[model samples]
Target: MKAARGSVVSKKGVPWGTIISVVAVVALAAVVVTYYLVQSAPKRALASWAPTADNPDPSLNIPGIVTGQYQASVHILPTERVAYDHSPPYGGPHDGYWAACNGVVYPVAVRTENMVHSLEHGAVWIAYNPDQVSGDALNTLKSKVEGKPYTMMSPYPGLDSAVSLQSWGHQLKVGSATDERIDQFITALRTNQNTYPEVGASCDALGAGAFDPDNPPPFDPTPPGPDAKPMDYQGSAGTQQDTGMPSSAPTS
Candidate 1:
């Protein structure tokens, strides 16, 4: 039988099979393109929020620009444990283990000490108070964090603010998820080799016991005792100058 003119049938006269295969191939390509766009949308949105000023190399000198937006740098002994002054510690002596920062968003609160170790590896920690942030705000924060390499987010049960962003020695807190600084902090610091103590370290393959997302380490939400080490310690116990601590708040 002669095939109709302008029909989809091949010269071999196979009609349905060839057409189906071509449609399937096109559909697969479309799926791939859609996935790429979806994955890249957050990054593209964040790029527009980056600072216009030349950002100093964080790996070179770890500049301490504490004038208005910046915070003071702090380094301390690599202690097995510490009572950090900050709820979600910015930087200080920390446990050897580091929470997995390869884009993991831990549902439960993570240990402050171990997360500090993640900061040392150039991971930005996004912490939020579960009681304060929920609904659309929480989802918005997750979109910015989930699947983003070298970043981690979890609840800080008694967080000083509704949301907090922390790098090696930098921190910024915002009252809401919509705050513009959320994107700016992530853009400025993720894998920023200069600001952290041990840059280029693997955020992955940290100790297996370090962080099991199914069962993350509980945060010590209680206020530090009078003897809790000050966060501004400069690489020595003696140099840890006393500083005011955040008042403890009820956990969500």
Candidate 2:
């Protein structure tokens, strides 16, 4: 309507600023939701692959998996060593004390005897050849082991493969760190009640001397001497009683 001269006019228009802010918030929310779903997808898939009576060891389904039938409760003195059948033994007679496998990543290659003990406790030992794996490849493997219970990783000085995963009697070697089978092996075996011997066994380090994760016994690269114990050798006397207990000396 016609109004008096110099009168102001009131206008109603779209709130562009408010509309832009709202759109931005919605877009951000969508991105966050997508990221969450993507990150969780692998874990969700792995959950379905848990060990079942009908399918006891799901890892057997994975290609290239090697299974063994090693006797349990066989222990060795800290001073002794095993002439393991495999380069990185999956299972066999081992030291009385166990390596700290509660998501530990040993900076140096740990003593084989102690690490095998961890496998008896359902820990998945991820061994990688330091010469073959490094940079992003090594980091990828670390992501899977770090902060995950019943899991550990170390540098295998003379490993034949880029990566080798060991869990009790199971072993899988892969040419790369990003192999899908790595995760599959871990999900199927680590702490799997149907597979490992010492169910509910602790992965924590026994203590300072027996098996210290911080200053663990170094890996012995030399060939197991003529005196090295055989795979079938029965444990030393009283060694079985020392399982899970700390010793006065560091395990080597």
Candidate 3:
């Protein structure tokens, strides 16, 4: 009888070991799944922040939304040069040529007029003050701009704010690179047809020669003409200055 009892006890031990092994495998899988979800939390949050059809206009009465008497007309100049009212121009007359908006990260400042052209093509331009942004903050902004079609970023030497985000007819200034509104602006305006002045304009169709991210046109800090018009498209062009626009438009 003792021998029979021993056999039954040994059989019970084998089953218990198998059950433990199964539980261990399941627990490992659950941990891996949890880790991936945690890693993707921020991206998921950004995706969820996107504007829907009913709420397409996120700029309306949105605090920090740039509202002013800026121009909203389109003028194509023979040159890629423009005299803009805003330092990081919202929109107005732009160079006939547009910067390549194919997810380019311009290390140096790009011409404001070329950038405005990109915005007209449904691109979102992000500008930051070099003196104010660096290290992780700068990298975070770069990641947002890099390899994402219809997006471009460049440093503005004399930006009135630490960072400014511009889309056609829209602008937002923020004090930090990690500001929640940064993502909000990108989500609300990036490729939003309702906000575009030229819908279906090809952002990538612009020839590569117009802009080279690695060797972009250096930012010219030359001040705009004394006759520089306010940010109005309907407003007539200011007398062409021999030099580029101002170092930065005075922020209201």
lDDT of each: 0.67, 0.89, 0.73
Candidate 2 has an lDDT of 0.89
Error of model 2, residue 218, in angstroms: 1.2
- Compared with the true structure, what per-residue lDDT tens digits does model 3 show for residues 1-252? 999999989877657778999999999999999999999887887675566787776665456887443333344443435567566887776655567787888888877877887887779999999999999999999988888888989999989999999988789999999998888788878888878766766666344454555565567788866554344433224322112232132212
Error of 3 at 80 (Å): 8.3
Q: Tell me the tens digit of each residue's lDDT in model 2 across 1-252.
A: 366332443343567899999999999999999999999999988886689989998998889999999988788888888999998999999988889999998889999999999999999999999999999999999999999999999999999999999999999999999888888898899899999998988899777868888889889999999999888887765563345454444322
> Model 3 misses residue 101 by how many Å?
0.9
By lDDT, who's the top model here? Answer: 2
TM-score of 3: 0.77
Clashing pairs in 1: 58-194, 58-195, 59-194
Instruction: Please identify model 1 stretches exceeding 4 Å from their true place.
Output: 1-54, 57-80, 205-207, 225-252
Top candidate (TM-score): 2
TM-score ranking from best to worst?
A: 2, 3, 1
Name the lDDT value of residue 251 in candidate 1: 11
